[model samples]
Target: MELNQRKGKVMIEQTLEDALSEVYLQISPNILESFPKFRPPVDLYIYDQAVAQVKKFHRAEARLGTEKQAVVATFARENLLFLLRDDYRVYAEHLSRKLGLVLVEDDFKAREVSEIFFIAFRDRMDVFLSQPKIEPFKELLRDVSILAEYLWTDPCRVEFLTKTLHKEYDLSVHSVNTMFIGLGLFVMASGARPERMEVVNLALGLILHDLGMTNVPKFITDKTQYLVWRDRGSIENHINAGLKKLERLEINDPTVRQCMSQHHERLDGSGYPEGLRADSMSMAGRLCAVADSFSAIIGDRPYHSSKVFNEAAGTLIADKGRYEPALTRLLVGLLKEGFPGCVGEDMN
Candidate 1:
């Protein structure tokens, strides 16, 4: 009877999970493993799983009042990972006692995961990395946008966003890192009062920039053989392929489409598919290009190991006609401050 009852409970949970998925358009497979990353955050596990991980978090937070805070406290208490911001590095005695959640600040480092996720993200890509296809991670982004939004404000988020971009790097990690970087650049470059929607779009665009790479066969992505120029040419088709794939979803924003399409186009007319020159590129395109290049070179990959920041910076600057000279320099500058948000302000 006990066994039957346990089975009944498991069955009920599975059914609920399925029903919740159908109701929410923004879905993620790592819902259970990740935190309640949505804005203002959510209280209950059910709401966190169904709403917090989706666009609905913004809506749900409005209707939820005091209970939401209590629930957030509960969720934070349950998940012990600390996300202390600089201001909160040392907590007051009273506040620490009152708040059950941990608030780690100042000192945290990269760690690995069995999957592409961690309770907190890290920069260490040695044996700690996971190489999954692009599709799953892209799908997971919607669920984690809230988390990504709040990462800059906390230490874990900063650590997660600063991870290296290797050849076999996890798609989700690289996308989120690029999103933060590109968004950071936009926020700084756009002005003291940049448009909020622009920040959102740039983040979304960078995260999904390489989404089409999932279409590439694993054999090719994992190809151990040295390829001739022709084989390499076919491999580079991911950018155009992504544009077409995203088009099928009927994405309404041209900015995102344009950003993705032109991310690889060189300023010197040396880039792929449609070799656009520097004069032809928009500020957004240039930002994404620099961000993508920086992210790609700083991580370890199956094809090649990660490059040091100085080495990568030198390469970008020296590679004439490949990247915007000024933007390349800014990317290098970003590394100095641990690549935090509000970089543009500092640059200015």
Candidate 2:
């Protein structure tokens, strides 16, 4: 029985690849009336059963509100259903709703949703980085909007994501971590409920703040040794590089532009790219600075050892006049209050 259970787990793991290829769409309001004319663009499958037997009920043969439909809805409720990857926009509303549900649900369901969403989101970022096209950029914004909504609904997701964040540094993961941390900071700082668009734009800025780093060569970014002046110059150029990419993509959102431009800028005129002082920086810029710095410190990179929650937060606190103190203190509060037992867990 143990062997069979292991085999079942393996099989499920194997099938997850195919499952991730599908997405979720909103159920049509007038399914019976819209049939034949507005059929599912791709073959539809009840995702729960598809793992064992990849059977698909064709759009042509199946009725909209039959047993299969019921099964599909059930699978969706259970987080077992998905639609074709290419047809992601076909049912984008449905996809967002399902993701929202998973985000606020139990730990197990949230983790399951995060694993799937992270892979897909990372791949989406990779595509945009590689191609640097308009469509992919827009898709990335939409994905971040969904992410922002998750935070709006449950701010504690920051602590949850912090606990689960990969200790090793990867640009994509770092960007995501920054988004969660930065957005959480924003939520905390803004006592009154912020506008929906404000959160969405801020989330986009935080996640894509490192977009310019993609332009820098891997040798410099991954260097374990001390970076020489020339290497440092190239690294600093990522801001300009990122701005250029945004220009190409025609992204004109003020918050996003400010974040990418000012994430590297410091409060005391000690940072690069612009060397803007405290009064010169925007709130968005200051928040990104703290979030980006804290994320880098906690994640294990080639040149730096990883710090636990307390150590990382302490480092930020110690750095006088560099990062915004209010923001830094809010982060510390989040680490202590948001995460139960975390204060003692990494004390050693």
RMSD per prediction, one decimal?
15.5, 10.8
lDDT of 1 by residue, 1-348 (tens): 012222211233556545543432111112212333443222233233322232222232344455664544443343311222221212222122222122222122221110132222222211122433345434443433433444434323333344433334666566656665666555445434444455556666776777667666666766667976766676678887777766765555766776788888898898866889988887778888888887777666677788886687778888887887877776666566544443221110
The TM-score obtained by model 1 is: 0.55
Against the true structure, what is each candidate's TM-score? 0.55, 0.68
RMSD to native, candidate 2: 10.8
Looking at model 2, the pairs that clash are 22-83, 23-82, 23-83
Worst 10 residues of 1 by lDDT: 106-115
| lDDT (Cα, 0-100) at 205 in candidate 1 | 74
Off by over 4 Å in 1: 1-168, 224-226, 338-348
The models' CA-based lDDT, in order, is 0.50, 0.67
Q: For residues 140-241, could you state the per-residue lDDT of candidate 2 as single tens digits?
A: 877766766765665544445544455768888788778767876887788645666898888788888889898789999999999999999999999999
